[model samples]
Target: MKLESHQFIRYFEPEQAAQISQIAIIKKFNPREIIFEEGDDSDSLFLVLEGEVEVSKRSGEGNNYVVITSVKSNGYLGELGIIDRKPRSARVVTSQQTVLAKIYYESITEILANTKGDIVLQILSFLSQRLRTVTTDYVNQLAYKEKMTLIGEMVNTIIHDFRSPFTGIQLSSSMLKELYPDQESQEWCDLISMQVQRMLNMAEEVLAFSQGDTTLYCQLIDIAKLLQNFAKLNQVYIDFASVELIVSVEEGLIINADENKINRALQNLLSNAVEALDQSEGKIEIRARRKDQLVEITFSDNGPGIPQEIQDKLFEAFVSYGKQGGIGLGTAIVKTIIDAHDGKIFFESSPSTGTTFYLHFPIAKID
Candidate 1:
């Protein structure tokens, strides 16, 4: 049923309703016709009178438009852009042959000048609601960006810590096999050596969380303390996920860095690792040390390794590895934070072999 201006007065005041009836033009749009594209400067408000309209935005690749929502008969659209004088953020198109009441910006102004105080209040109230919706959407986007940035930083730190131990374990294991010729006890020694090497590899994976070649701030930092505090804060998630976490870092190691951001970055990486494991029994290892002018950290997990195809772009925002319901923002956050701290990250992985990240930060000058 088509709603008359008087019947739809709930959306506008009596005086405003009268003004709309006088100036609003009823226009018919063909099916699949575009009402306006994003950034179009048609400052007009539209009220759907018949059929439906869809609002959508062009996806990142521009090949598709992700529909935000739809408007049915008696529903209104476009007031926000018209009132605020901003470009339309999304396109609106007719889903069928649609009839709409179009009120141009000039008509709205004239109506407001002639309208009663109560009618003006009603219009203002509707605009306020639209503003709130836009503000909430903006806040969500900002938060997602911040989270991705933090994840990136953590990956960088993990790589740095893993490099030294990985190098040592690789070199030491080879030497140990050469020096100890007894095959009987060699198997057990090899087991211990293998575990150590795995630890080193995990560190490298964590470090790889940073996307590319970037400068990092070196610093002396107490790695053990950092892990302990992080574990305490995230204990609920750890317990809920049935994940085991291990930490190893000397107390006196002072690493040069923006330690606070590093902590946040690591938190994001670890949280994602735990989530990736789902309901399975997951284990995470964190190790760090200060060597020469560098501070290194590694974060490794015993869950499924990243898929080969996605592993290459895992650090890019919204690049998920076929994980159901995954938004793919965690590793991106890890990269941004690390970049801000002037650090580097690297990753290593194989299916079922698990994944590890290495992070490196430069140490503060001893002098």
Candidate 2:
């Protein structure tokens, strides 16, 4: 990462650099060393000659700083103060053993005073680029906030309007099941009920996770019955004739968790499994077991598997791989809900076998 002064000071004439070198203050830094802090009026601009430094700003919260970006070798530093003698607004700390060449404000002022000076022009270019970047970021952030607010309001309206129709559909499906004489018609009614329930689960997940309405009412969950119900529910949305969905949840396995949230997390995994399957051939297997003080639930699918491009950031928000029309919130919400329950989630995937997601939850002891 060692960089020569010429690379960074290319905007300057050879004579100008020779003049600045006469008053240059070269400083070496160790890892985690601070170059300058916020509000410091030391009045020095720096050129990074080696290593990397993290640039961060003081957060709105008291006594916290958030990282903004990194400055590597050949990059200019403290350009925000090159023109006017303003106090440092951002903190700069060395991320590794570093070396910086510092030029005092007095020297820059001397250069700026020169009628044929290139220093002022270079500083102006730096300032304008910075201003443009900041403005763009601010606009993007504001737009994102606005979009999320609109979506939240829309979800609220949809939730209120959706429940009545869903309830009516459930009720009508129940009535139709009893009245329908043909077995095929009865199965269709059951399918309707299952699809409606899936929609309800998805809507609830969106409200609770996306809208940040996290109010978990924990209850003792029967694992075996839940698995049986999962199998029944999954059969409705997927092509059972082509995909083999096998679930073996041992009986008597119990846990205390938010039933709705945990169910939502598990349903996400099942949905992912179904989606991963090829149209004509795929297999999904679910296994739940208790060992020592932890319960393990695994969902594995035999499909093309997760794309290599997304394996590292698999659970990061909005990082979808190759799924068509995917918003990419499924795994992120799954991780969030599992973390809330004091559980851990991870996955192993490759082109060799399909993808397998593992969920580990602490076993709750019943006195």
The candidate maximizing TM-score is 2
lDDT of 1 at 225: 73
lDDT of 2 by residue, 72-104 (tens): 888767876766678987789999998898988
Quote the RMSD, in angstroms, for model 2.
8.6
- TM-scores across all candidates? 0.40, 0.60
Which residue runs does candidate 1 get wrong by more than 4 Å?
Answer: 1-221
Q: Which is the leading candidate under lDDT?
A: 2
Q: Over all chains combined, what TM-score does candidate 2 have?
A: 0.60
lDDT of 1 by residue, 52-117 (tens): 998877756754665666778877788775567788888899988899888888887776787678
Compared to the true structure, candidate 1 yields what TM-score?
A: 0.40
Local distance difference test, each candidate:
0.71, 0.77
